[model samples]
Target: MGIELLDRTALVLFSGGQDSTTTLAWALDRYDHVETVGFDYGQRHAVELEVRSVVADGIRRSFPDWGDRLGEDHMVDLQVLGRISETSLTKGMAIAMADDGLPNTFVPGRNLIFLTFAAAVAYRRGIRHIVTGVCETDYSGYPDCRDDTIKAMQLALNLGMDTRFVLHTPLMWIDKAETWALAKLLGGDELVDVVRTQTHTCYEGDREHIHDWGHGCGACPACELRATGYRGYLARQQA
Candidate 1:
């Protein structure tokens, strides 16, 4: 089967998590020229940065065909963004509801900024497509994860930079289980195994307490959502 993509080159906003890793595979499958970019925004789960390094290396080693086509993987430092935001992901504060009913983990304009920086990077590299793993379903209530926000950001980017950059959200409408299905479809079972065992999604970044969903503390909302989705996907496969 041929990979369904309108563009031949892409840049994925990879974070070395389940969804972002899956998105990377999706890009690798379709785009002839693909690269990944990650952010270091002073998050509490700094281990994910290490995980990103390992996962990027693993992709190059395991999937040589895809890796050969892959471009330079970038890790941009945005600690100033974290310093200005009071989110739990960055500041390690309590997970309380904000005045707008969003979680304390909602870092305002983080995704927007990430996508904008990604657009600049892509424009410089002559890439027009930017793939992100943001989703609304089974998400952590980050407003920036919404499709509308992405569209707005895309338009803002194109207008601001005078470049026709297409923001691709492959997992925008899919839940966690469907995201796993996508990984299997794009990279096959080995890719599924890699994502299940290698990626980091825990808020605490506890690699010791491995679960069906991946490595997580099992107490945070991210772990709960991931584990539940993995169980659902497994059941679906069995049935």
Candidate 2:
């Protein structure tokens, strides 16, 4: 657990979703102080902040010793800066989440912007290690989530700030099944409870189906991925 030495401090890019919630648990174990950052880009499902606040609050309650390590309002008024090629997340376009191929849900430069800002935040705090829940294996054609992109960004951020920084993505190679497995490893069955109840992955900004793990729509691309991963995890357990 060489990575566990990161216990003193780290920053997390949280979106109150399965990936981010899993990242939070992972952060709690490894980092002595984990600071979570979430962005509000006026997304289609902006209700995520409500869920995010709940999750952060829970973290403070559960890890009272590490109280207030979570930071709020890492978000920007992205609506003004959100202009890009037609995207479901950037625009209110009713684009279907990609199923067979890359979906419109992929907002260009989103992860780039978020990570850069997160790095800036870490820099201000004199922290170099930053943890995020970005996954490439399970990624649905989001160009920003690639390993090469991450490395490049790391270089750019470090050079721009003239400081040492390590962008850590624990779920990069792992699929969602593995992510669920990791969450369970960190938080046990509580993983399911928090992921399903606290995380927000809905394109529709829903909370009605909070009990359905991270799956939002049965037909949407995001929902399909979550369902597939969850089922794969269950199958593994059964086997």
TM per candidate: 0.94, 0.87
The 10 consecutive residues of candidate 1 with the worst lDDT sum are 1-10
lDDT of 2 by residue, 195-227 (tens): 866777767775666335553655556666787
Per-candidate clashes come to 0, 2
Q: Model 1, 93-190: lDDT tens per residue?
A: 77677888987878899998999889878877778789999999889789899989999998888788876778999999899988888887888788
Off by over 4 Å in 2: 1-7, 61-73, 97-101
lDDT scores of the candidates, listed in order: 0.86, 0.75
Model 2: per-residue Cα lDDT at residue 204:
74
So what's the TM-score on candidate 2? 0.87
Clashes by residue pair, model 2: 7-31, 7-32
On TM-score, the candidate that comes out on top is: 1
